[model samples]
Target chain A: MFASIMYKEWLKIRWTYLGGAVLGVFIVFEIFLNLGQIIEFNKANSVWNYIIFQKYLFYSDFQFLPAFIGLIVGIAQYFPEIQDKRLKLHLHLPMRENNLLLSMVAIGTVLLIIIYSFLLIGLSLVTLIYFPYEILVSLLNTVLPWIVAGFVIYFIAAALFIEIRWARRILIGVIAFAFVSMFYYYMGYDSFNKAIPVFTIIALSLSLLILLSGYRFKRGTK
Target chain B: MLVKTSRNILILFVIFVLAIFVPDFYWKIFEKNIRAPFVLYSPVIHDFIISKFDDKTMVRMDNEGNLLTRDEYEELEPLFFYRQIVMTGKMPDSLDGMEIDIQELRRNNFSYRIKPDAIEEPFIQLYPLLESKSGRAKLEMPDEFIRLQNRCEFINCESNEVVEDLSETFSKAFTDIGFKFPAAKIFGNPTTRKPFDEGYFITDSAGDLFHLKRVKNKPYLKKVNRPNGVNVKYIVVTENERREFYAILVSEASKIYLISYNDYEFINTPIEDYDYRVHELMMRGNILYRSFTFSSDDMIRMVVTDREYNKIDQYDEEWISRENTSAGKFSKMVFPFTLSIIDAKEPFINFYFLFSDTRALIGIFISLIIAVILYLRKKIKLKFIWIDYIVILLTGIFGLIAVLLVRYEE
Candidate 1:
């Protein structure tokens, strides 16, 4: 049954994962290419010094790309279920309705993880070419919240896109925005040191939201 | 099983959302701007002068509370606003019986802020030792950065590999100076914008202070002796142009010591009773008076020291925090609790709820009345909904809104 549900989700989201993967890899390549140009044009030591002391970011544009892909993939995966009231048919399936919806979310989450993993490994390899472990590790830590946000937005946007009622949808939208905005709040160098645990819990817990939203949708509460 | 779990998840999500969003919304709409008072030492009156924020006007007064014109205020804090005073052609020829050197005054004038957030932020334990005496016109950044774990390793940037010779050289120099390996803390001003690079102030694993600099591509390591019982907590590297001090070493007890260039000596600054966790230290200096202002959200404590590090005078001021304001007061009648995300002292966001004080009882009473009215208007049964009552008792109007917005899953 889980494999069947996973196959259905795969049918719904294959194009999305493909496009998101292409876009994600393109961004990773661009970030590395930009860093290469910086290393080529400037004194490498001065650039590293500025980054260490002044908190210079050579790949800031990459920060929002992960979350953007998450949102696009989420909408692509879930909007089809709501169209023509298809989720009602989903509720009547032999499997438990909650497990079906949650399975869909799990598949999307796993896909996002796989796609983001490609970028993370690519980024780590590119960073190691010039910088030492201390900086490469710090840079990875700095971007961890953003990647975490990508996974989180997938779950939250799934919940948002599948919610039955407009009023609840708006309320959930506002709440989700406030929740996600916290990831980008402190832009200071290494500012997410202590808050990483809090953010991780919040991001991972986004899966549970599908249960609540699915419950509402199953009841057809408008 | 999923419905049962969904109920708990819904409750958790509701609490998280309400606790983060409600207080933020309240503060956004009601927060008032606070203009804090600034204190400076007046070389003319030889007393501390204060410029106070009085609603709409800037009121200048001495410690005695007599109001004066803007001219008197600027004249009093001449050293602080010396350029303006000099432009006004009302310069004092001599202060404290010594002729003021404008050039010398300009050279030493600098300010710094030491906050708990900055000190508490995590750092990469590696440091680059830029050669101080480069023989060039300006400072040059080093080709490698050193990390001292079990031993010091200078990893070159280009090859992304360790320079074993240079690392061993410094590692031997560090061990020769009796530095315990695996340094506890390291502080350095790594920017070339500073007047000169002073390298780094490292606290060894044994909590001893050591001054490490690279001069002409060789390690100049010195073990600094601390005053007995003055344990170092954090070191702030100040590469100011004047070169009076290399760094300011903060002791565990909040005592500050100036790490002077004079043979790596540490002179204790007169400022005292500062806490590394609470108070933010703001230091401003000129040719005459060195002013230290220790501040928290609740109070401002200013101390002035003469050139010899003698405490000349001290003044303290405080105002009611925003949490006790009229808006905060009114919020107690609306929300049984408010949530705060930012720590103000730390650079992070977390869910923290501040329950309203005694006045929130009014909010609870009003909420119950409204809930009863809603039950009557909707013709719903009067049987108790435990969730509604629980939310109202904890969050008052915010809970009421949550209940109304998220209607019963009948």
Candidate 2:
């Protein structure tokens, strides 16, 4: 049952996910090219000097890609379900309503994890060519929170758009906005290490908020 | 029951957003930056020089408030701006019968500043240990960085491999000094472009302070004996050319101590109530005297000490936070309560609730009268209209918006 639901979700978002993957790799490729330029053009020892002495960022342009992909995957997955109350057909299946809802969310989440993991691994490989392990670690740590924030935005946006009541939707939206704002607050690299545990808990809990919207939809509260 | 639970959740969300945003909006529109003067002690004049900035123009005055010209101010503050004075050929030869040399002045001058925001901020764990004594005129970057977690291990930068020999030597150095495995905190400037490197001051799991440096090709570890009953909270490494001190150690008790170079000893500075976590510290030192200034958001304290760190004079300045303006006063009257999640001391956003001032009662009374008049206007029965009263009383304008937007539904 879950496989069928996941396939349905994949059918909805496969193109969007592919586009996101292509864009993510392009950004990482751009960072690799830029680093090559810096290392090649500078004098003998200046590349290391600038990197160590100054706060030089390699893949700053890639910071927004995770959020962009998350947004796209979210809209592609849920926008159809909300049209003409097509979600009711999915809910009426032999599977439990909660299972159906959670399975749909899981599909989106797994897709996001796969997409973002590809980006992170590609970034790690690219950074290894010109930079050291220290920078690779720092850059990975810095980008992790932003990526986590991106996925959380997707989860909350799905939950926000599924609700039937405008009043309650706005209320959920305001709360989710506050939650999503936290991930992008721009603390330096590896600073989020301490908050990551707490944020992960919050992000997982947010995955269940779709249940609230389903309940409202069932109640026909519009 | 589901509707009730969901409505309660909605109410809580509305309240949280209103509390955090309303007060923030007030401050955002009414905010102003208050500029304060920089005061420094002049060993040349044996008095304080006030460098006041009024918008774009800067005017200098003596302790007696007499306006001094640029040259006079530069001469008056030779130690503060000694290089500029000497280059401009305005530096006095002697001060109070003590001859002043530019080179000597350069060696002794040092400055330290700590802002409150940096305390709450998180920094990367990986630190580079630059060679403190490279034998060259200039220091160069090391090929590795040390990560202190389960163990203090140095990894080669290029190959992404651990340097076992160097790591073993440094690990053994720490173990010899009774440093417990896995360092708790490591403080180092980590840049070679500074005058010199002081390496890193590492605190082990048992809270013992040890200095680690690569000196003359081998690791030099010095175990610093912390004062009795004092637990160090933060260590600021001072790599001044004079090498008067290795770092400034702030204790959990809010006491300040200087880790001096002579015999690797701790010299107690006469600074009390020095909370490194909350206050910003500005310290300026010259040939004869040092001025230590610490300020929180609302007040500033400037303490002068001689070469021996004896208290010479202390001055205080207290001012109202710009948020206490007329707009702030009006916000108290207009809102029943404001929720704010952001705070200066927190690294991330979270909930903080502030009940409005007693003047908020006026807002409540006005809202109550309006709700009552509406009930009478519609001629609605008591039972159905009761939730409106509850929402109005609890959330003020925020409740009114929620209740009106959603309408009465049960």
Candidate 3:
């Protein structure tokens, strides 16, 4: 039952992962435009320039596109269930509600990681044209923050949808986006600096709690 | 059902409080950054034009105390046209009798007869005037000539004559009232000569009263001790050979009085119409003759000063006399360093510090908003998701700790 639910969640998120890949291609194309400028200036040969270009590609507009796709995927995972009132059907199933929630979150998290992996690959291909093995390693280290950011947004979207039961999810999501945007505007990027760690711990704790809730539901059914 | 509702309400309340108060708490912990008063830039006005091209002819005063023409003053302009005027200088011990005579001649357009016997040892002593014992000591001089010398190291003697005369008059009045220099022991240091304490007894040839107190220390002299009315202090006196004019830099130490170049009645007749244009012109044309006055309580009252013109048609008359309190105390307490990294062009690491702190706040707000939306949508279907709560708790705690670590590191 858990496998089936997980498969269903994966089906919901597969397009989002594809969309992220497409977005990654566009980012690489944009990065090439800048690289052309560097090549003209004869500054693209060095590993540092390559690293800088990679950093810009990952951190610039490309970073948000992936996160945005992840958010939509996260929202789409439950929106259909809420719309059809099919969430109540899960209660009738022998499988625990906590198990169902865990499967959904796990699937959502895995989808984001896959999306981020594709983005990393895209960055690697573009960076490989100029960067060496060591610089690629450094660039890989920088990608950790973006990946963490993706997971964070996924978990937050899950939590928000689980907490609020109406179409207001989109509204709440937009408001959340606006609030975060304002903070980013004032504070700058690297919101992951403090936020990523917090999100990690929260996701872990929430996963455990969902499992326990499922266990309780199973016991009640028995 | 009520119990569940209450529990949810309690959870929401806790989240709300954390969301609102956490940022402020974090801000309070790192209040040092917000309160730190860093200097954006130092007031260093380098180049300036003096007058219109037509009237731009430089004037100078010859040795015979006459305003020489532009042709005569051509050779003298370089002597007075300083590439750099060093405001910071060590106080000279004393001025010679000849120097005093020269200063007097430059200031008054008439030379004073200096008797060798009349010359007295010039010293500074601190005198406490207020009952609170918070009075500043003044440096005294025999006459206005000595006073100008004591104020500025013979920089602008002519413009300082008015201030010197005022100090001489006041010092004589104070001395006649049996106001002796407070004992050296009162300052707690006997060997070190406090420049403010030395008062010159200004007496006529027969030692008659010319009530005046010459203040050698520019900072102390710039402070107005009067409860009411304006007090002028001599900043510098320089003899300009190019202009053939003796320029004296003076500033009012009074906070209450506004320094204006409005036409004052000369002998009950309006000397000139109240023209801001001319006042602005005079203020601008005279670059070396600027006044910066502040209140007795250290509030900057005004800075009515001139700046050099960079263009021929441009009249850059910068009279920035702001009545604002000095942020000295706040800056000292919050930002200890005179040269802060915040003013640097690159500020690479500092930028990271500010960015990280701001990002932390953003993260918290974003997480909260997302959580609220999820809670409202019932998408978070984990019935009793203690793990999510614990995760949130841990994240908040860790974020807070990280913020604290950065602040303490600073």
Isolated chain A TM-score, each model: 0.95, 0.93, 0.69
Tally clashes: model 3. 69
- Tens digit per residue, CA lDDT, model 2, B267-353: 887877667766888887888887789987677778899877898877666766654767767778777777644456555444446
Model 3, which residues run further than 4 Å from truth?
A45-59, A133-138, A164-199, A203-222, B1-410
How far does residue A102 in candidate 3 sit from its true spot (Å)? 0.8
- What CAPRI-style quality would you assign to candidate 3? incorrect
Candidate that beats the other on TM-score, 1 or 3, i.e. the better one: 1
Model 3's i-RMS, to one decimal, reads 24.8
Whichever of 1 and 2 has more lDDT, that candidate is: 1
TM-score per prediction, in order, is 0.92, 0.82, 0.37
lDDT of candidate 3 over B106-183, digit per residue (tens): 333211111111112112222211111124353222211222212212111213223444455545544455443331
Query: Which stretches in model 2 have alpha-carbon errors above 4 Å?
Result: A1-7, A25-61, A82-103, A117-141, A156-182, A194-222, B1-15, B52-75, B83-90, B332-410
Q: Each candidate's fnat, in order?
A: 0.55, 0.15, 0.00
Error of 2 at B328 (Å): 3.6
Give the top-scoring candidate (TM-score). Answer: 1
- In order of TM-score, best first, we have 1, 2, 3
DockQ (C-alpha based) per candidate is: 0.58, 0.26, 0.01
